[model samples]
Target chain A: ARPRVGYYFTGKTGSQVLTDKIKKLQVKDFQSIPVVVAENVSVYDAIVTMFLEDVGTLFVVDQGSILVGVLSRKDLLRTSIGKQELSTIPVNIIMTRMPNITMCEREDSLIDVAQKLIEKQIDALPVVKLTEKGIEVIGRITKTNMTKALVSLAIDGLV
Target chain B: ARPRVGYYFTGKTGSQVLTDKIKKLQVKDFQSIPVVVAENVSVYDAIVTMFLEDVGTLFVVDQGSILVGVLSRKDLLRTSIGKQELSTIPVNIIMTRMPNITMCEREDSLIDVAQKLIEKQIDALPVVKLTEKGIEVIGRITKTNMTKALVSLAIDGLV
Candidate 1:
């Protein structure tokens, strides 16, 4: 018979220990309530919503809050300062469309999500779950959230 | 005399080898020319600069390019949407001040810079070098840059 082993028993500062902790973390543990906007919303309204929500990124959802697209501050800033009028422009025109957006599920590992964020060079990801209808956005995982987790781990001397 | 040994002699995945390579990198190798703006510039002008530079964060510098403060897209968005007039308002009032800004030197480790970025919850860090005059803004290291490095390593099977 083989003996069962504990993961954390290795040296405290070992990278394996930190890697294990990150892998064990679920996206739901750190994801925040997603700030969403409908695709048809005017760019002006979208800007106001962004400022009001205090979030740099906004998830564009459908009538049932199903993920459709993603909009960022750069998108709005570029559109606003461009020749087009903000009042008449809809977010759908500037948003990164679906089937191209990178997403994560609630059960996704934190390490995997972090990799996606880095690889994609994006600020946030919609934490979604597959359903009978389609993908439903339940929460959001951002660089800030990952940073918070890392900082907490550091402060606790667990990293 | 101690026997000479190599760090990569152990049989590890190419990704692990790349991870080791990244851990040894310094901030200077990854930093890029910083996008900067004057403190007295109007908020509208700053937005234009950001758009032109294609950067979300702009380092606020004084005469001789001395580091003073930092400005982010969120800051501009909030200030512009507020009661204050963007045309008349200056960036100094809204920028994060000197004493509170997190900075790094060229000699700093990449891992340290990454930790600082995560810990401070900021998108970028002003990679500064101490000069006879004062701290000079040599370059900047952003999350996007770091992401690019990570992605490159991953592609090379070194992550």
Candidate 2:
């Protein structure tokens, strides 16, 4: 018998979000800001931008601004040392492209979110919501916030 | 006000543990397995392990078997050429040690896991879990698995 989709479909709610579960815990939370860059960014400028931002990565986006690939410090450094100089290289030239990016729906459970992280070998996921046009990027999730919550929850969910 | 802890605690399921979460997905699932080695293992052996395992990096574990460091495939090979001879050297001689290691708990949300992988400038995660004895080692998460899972899930979930 086919399993019912209704059984698996979850309601997007605060209680379902792992953050809310851990919100009361007194600890650092993972911020939602994800550094983004244009897909055609020159390698030289991208590296400078990353350094300026003090972040190790940038999200390459389309003109519509949805995430298309990930440009890491290492990726930029590697491409820079190669024959192609910054001007000749596009962000897409060495970027870790998608659908290689791990992503989640706003409705996903923190447990489900964590599972995806471990299973995906990724450090960040772009949270999105379903819309008539397509999957729309919305927020980000971090491991630190999840950990603080998890520790509290593991202690019998003590607040 | 404190919420009720009784209903909040997620109990042990026994099977499909946090370790299982790390191992269940292959790179084919777009996840990466963090490869590892013993502290006493020669850099030569570490190289061989890297090739055989097809992993780009490895973790170094201590006498009690707790993870102590990370060694990229490139770092191991580059440092091994003149830094230490396999005949008398140990991975600990050159491996980047912990708490330098970018690690995550079994319960961390995937969003954070992905961020750590990207931010840490490394390719894998050693999922750890607390046991009655102490914090014990679990399976690895890798970049290959992360990408593979991304490709697979993108197709499976979206298309």
Candidate 3:
């Protein structure tokens, strides 16, 4: 028979308790609905979509909504300021391509997501899941969402 | 005579060293050029400006560049999605008011700025200075900047 181990109490206090709670929390607990756009969309339209969606970062997907790349406000802003025509430019040109993007699974710990955000120097991560077709973006985890989680935990005195 | 205290090391290692470095860093050390827009500018124009400047947040200023309010991409996105006309809506109406805006001085510690970014549930903070004319917008400190600093420290093995 396998030995059963009960939960252990380490007597965590102060910020340590907060860290523990964050580590215990998963990305699915606070992920928000993702705002995505087609990879071939014009930068101008993408900007409008971003405004309409109330999101700073927009995931660029294919016709089937499969994750392809990611675009941020900075990318669009940089393109707009350039001499190139915004309406003629496609978002795929400036987006961070796949294999270079950092994403988190639903089961990823919030602390790991936060660390990735810092290490990767990005504002948000696309929450994704692996399917037979490949990776599909289901939601997004952002600094704002993490902050809300922290605030809630603080309010509840759990951290 | 005041007693002189000698510097002491607690023998921090690895991540602890990084934490100590981050805690000792100040906002001024990593602040970036601030993007500002006139309060009377239309939401459409503000979005364009944000794109042109490649910034997620824009500090709303008056004729003298005095700090008045703050606007984020989310604000513009929310407003653009609303029923109101985007071209006619002024940013001042949607911006976070001065009293409610959280700002940091140039001398503030980076750790404190990071904490405020979490506690207030905001991404960027305007780095301001108290002058005879009033508060002047000097720069901006953001999560991206903080992450860059952390990454650099990690790369240098200083943290």
Task: Quote each prediction's TM-score.
Answer: 0.70, 0.43, 0.60
Interface RMSD per candidate: 6.9, 10.6, 8.6
Clashes (backbone N, CA, C under 3 Å), per candidate, total 3, 32, 3
The candidate with the higher TM-score, 1 or 3, is 1
Stretches of candidate 3 off by over 4 Å are A1-16, B1-122, B127-132, B136-159
Instruction: Give a tens-digit lDDT track for model 2, residues B1-159.
Output: 545643322343312232233333332223344566788988767777866775556778776767777787546534533424465777888888766766666555554565566666565777776666644557676554443333232233211
User: RMSD for each model, in Å, please?
Assistant: 6.2, 12.1, 8.7
Single-chain TM-score of chain A, each candidate: 0.87, 0.62, 0.88
> Across all candidates, what is each one's fraction of true contacts kept?
0.08, 0.00, 0.07
Q: Alpha-carbon error at A141 in model 2, in Å?
A: 2.3
| Candidate 1 residue pairs that clash | B15-B157, B15-B158, B18-B158
lDDT of 3: 0.75
Give the 10-residue window scoring lowest on summed lDDT in candidate 3 chain A: A6-15
Task: Kindly give the stretch of ten consecutive residues in candidate 1 chain A with the minimal lDDT sum.
Answer: A5-14
Looking at model 1, give its docking quality level.
incorrect
TM-score of 3: 0.60
Error of 2 at B13 (Å): 20
Q: Pick the candidate with the highest TM-score.
A: 1
